[model samples]
Target: MRVETIFEMTSPYRDSFRIKGFRFGNGEKTLAIAGPMRGDEIQQQYICSQIVRRLTMAEQHGRISEGKSILVIPSCNPFSMNVSRRFWAMDNTDINRMFPGYSQGETTQRIAAAIFSALEGFEYGIQLASYYVPGDFVPHVRMITTGYETLDTAKLFGMKFVSLCKPRPFDTALLNYNWQIWNTKAFSVYAGCTSRIDSTAASETVDAIMRMMQAAKILTKTVTLSPAYEPAVVDESELLHVKASHAGIFYRLKSPGSSIESGDVLAQIIDPYNGQCLSEVKSPADGIVFFAHNQPLVFENGLIFMIRGM
Candidate 1:
């Protein structure tokens, strides 16, 4: 096992910003795993830390395959993480939106360029990712539907689902998309929630990552058990969004990963001042809850749940 600083920026007011990577085994660049690029992604960071810990143990026990090297970076933007900000502290920019970046463009661009430079030339890239929305997701592997993507390889992660995302205009700058264009098989892995750790979901993600490494022959041993699920393939557009009709305090009854039938009571909107139930949100179709709003408050027409129709 080896640790190295892949990117660094000096600061007069604070500690230098450094992106450190933990490498296991020695040989070809086989895989690269990255954690949070956002400050509030505590759950994402935790998942990557667990991957690093397990890989460290695997290297010690000679479980990492010979002629295979894997790099795991636990966090990319620790400066923002330190202050609990969601984006770049100085400019309020997202590091994730600047990928395959310009070295001379801006602070985040330089950081992105440095990090992406270090990440290149790997057979696989896995990012412990979070949703842009504040919500809980059923743990799954997601991929941008670049022409080079293959769902078969993504299914190797052994998560419950594999989401094929149809990229929007802004997606061209994403690390996962750029990695795919650069001939790397990239995957975005989501845990159940962000900002707080979910032990059950975190354990499942760690197991899935190790299982993928073992399947790719980068590791000789893995902590994963017998395959627990056959991944359901879903396009991102297929999800049914259930929205809040009234602005109020939200009371949710369903969570991510729950199976629901049409007309099931999903939630209720409560009048905070009067303590009266203003409205009830119900499921419109039989499906699995792919995502559920995590916050206690909601606005009219705000997304509450995204169901994967069965």
Candidate 2:
């Protein structure tokens, strides 16, 4: 295992900031796994750490395939992580939103450019990603419907679900979208939650990546998937959005992975001062919950749950 600096910037206030990459095996570039670009993605960073550990043991045991190279960048924005901020510590900009970035642009853009440049030329790319809202996700592999995306490559991870998302207007600047445009097949893996770590989800995520590596000939050793999974390919149209009717304290009766029928009481909003039930949020369709808000407070029209309809 070799550790190399991918990008670095001198900081007058403190130590220099550096984005480092861990390399496994030697020869052609094969796979690149990136971790959190924002500071609050503790779960994302933790998953990437586990991936590094897995790769380390694989390399030490000579399980890594010959003439194959894999790189893992555990965290992209360490400064924000250290300070407990989500975006860039300096200007509060998101590193993720600035991709295939201009070197002469803002600080975050420069960082994005540097990181993206290093990730190019890989056969496959995996990002430990998180949702925008504070919530729990049913661990899955997410793929953008870019013209270059191939579902066959995404299924190699062997996760329980493959979410096919159509890129929004701003998605053009995201790393996953840019990677495909640059001729690199890319995937984003979400492991249940964002700020908090979920061990079961993390383990499942690691196992899936290893299984993919083995199947793709990046590893020579056999990898067995636990409990077995026949992943469901789900797109946005199959999802049912459940929102809160009033703003107040959120009391959830269901979580991600829960199965619910139509009219099921998913959650209730309580008046913050009076402790009175403001409104009850119910499921509109019979389906499995794909995502659920876990935060304490909810605003009117806030997303409470996303169910994949049966």
Candidate 3:
């Protein structure tokens, strides 16, 4: 049980903020958890911090057990966290994009190097994440590769579904790159989107983390997760891009987080000057609606919704 703070130059605008790591218990199976490498996904950092706070309380109250060590880096990139941005100010690069970081590379690369070096020989690494891009609040778990092992591991998180996503092998993504080098068991939990705090997504993420802790025997309390809610699990192959056909004022007839059927009137694009409808977008599949553009004005070829079939 130890706590360490690493301080170094992270960006040009300001000195590096402290990267805090907490080790709990004295178990042989060590776990490393990280969150919010991107500045935009600051909510994820908050989520990790909550977990650390709980674990710290448990340790102080003599609730933690023997033979298990857990290391949590609440916020990996503090510079971005301070400004609520997603990239380091120095090079404007996504920190998660720099993995297996180099000592002489870039700012983000150096932070990754320090974190990855600390993660060596851990039993499992869980990368915390949220949809930092323009997307809907969909809580999901992802793995870097396929095979039943990783799939099962993702499923154990007790989320609605696990997405089988593959990162480019040599892309230097923090999770994928570090996984390759350390070769320790790893998975990532993604919830909500950038700059928005979806309470449902946050709760689901907390539930997933508790489930993992129970599976690892780090926490003795028996956890009963809600029966998995059936979700529209669509592969990257099944994703239908609903693009706006005409430029006009867009009105969504339906909201995200709701089920829709094929041919349903999802939205209508109308001419601003005239009351006449310019174009109507209909659902092509029976699935859940996500990422509905609520704005009245829309551009041609703008993404309206992403429907994942049931």
Candidate 4:
């Protein structure tokens, strides 16, 4: 296993803080696995590094006999990683939105392009992600477009649910867009929230990577995986959004992943100025609470939570 250190730019905090990655196995079939482009996404990066360490150890001991190459980039943005922010340092630009990258463009575009160039020509790609928004999202794989054999690859990940999606212009996210251009077979494995770390989500993501390696015949032993979810696919449009009815301090009535019926009390917004119950946010439909905001203080037009039909 050969490891490489690439730097997007020199950081002021630490001189030439490098981005760490590993290239393993001298085989024809290549697998590129990348973690969060956002610095705050530490969990995703940690899990990817774990995968690399395990694979490297196995290869060192001659345990892995399969003829396949693997590349693991644990973290992409060191500046953001330092401050635990989600965007780049030069500007608060989201690197995911910039694709196939630009050398002469903005800071984010330059870095995004550099990462893409470094990751070119992989037979399979797995982009590990942490949900930046609220709620403990169920582990799932998201495909960029439809009717590609890549959708079938979800089975190998051992994830219960998969979300089929097409990226919009705003969604020109680096990984998704790069996958489209490179024709690299890829998917986004989203495990937990961005601002927080969830150990369960991290384990699930690591297991998913192992499943993929097993399918590739990289590991000789059988890989055990959890059963697929009953409803294997969730459409992006079907994610029902629930909003606050009035401005107040909210008291959450339920946790995410709990089944809900229409009119179920989702939260209670209380007037902060006075000890008065301002309003109650109820479930809009019979479904599972997929996401909830951390900010208990709510405004009249604030989005409270989201539920997806079971």
lDDT of each: 0.92, 0.90, 0.71, 0.74
lDDT of 1 by residue, 1-310 (tens): 7899999899879989999999988999999998899999999898998888888888888998889899999999999999999999999999999999889989999999999999999999999888888999999999999998979889888899999998999999999999999999999999899899999899898889888888888989555454657899989899999999999999999999999999999999999999999999999999999999989999999999999999
Better of 2 and 4 by TM-score: 2
* Residue 262 miss distance in model 1 (angstroms): 0.5
Instruction: Give each model a TM-score.
Output: 0.98, 0.97, 0.85, 0.88
Off by over 4 Å in 1: 222-227
Query: After TM-score superposition, what is the CA distance of residue 56 in candidate 3 from its true location, in Å?
Result: 2.6
Q: How well is each residue in 193-221 modelled by candidate 4, as lDDT tens digits?
A: 55566777777778787777777676656
The superposed Cα distance between candidate 4 and the true structure at residue 239, in angstroms, equals 2.0
lDDT tens readout by residue for model 3, 35-84: 77877776687678778877777677665657778888877887776776
Off by over 4 Å in 2: none
Relative to the true structure, candidate 4 reaches a TM of 0.88
Top-TM-score structure, candidate number: 1
User: Model 3, residue 88: what's the lDDT?
Assistant: 75
2 or 4, greater by lDDT: 2
lDDT leader: 1
What digit string (tens of lDDT, one per residue) describes model 2 on residues 1-310?
9999999999879789999999999988899998999999998999899889988988889999999999999999899999999999888899998999889998999999999988999999999887777889899999888989878878888888999999999888899999988888899998898888889888888888888898799999685566547788999767888889999999999988888999999998999999999988989999999999999999899988999999
What clash pairs does model 4 have? Answer: 101-113, 131-194, 160-229
Please identify model 4 stretches exceeding 4 Å from their true place.
11-13, 61-65, 131-135, 146-149, 223-231
Error of 4 at 198 (Å): 1.3
Cα RMSD of all models vs. native, in order, equals 1.1, 1.2, 3.1, 2.5
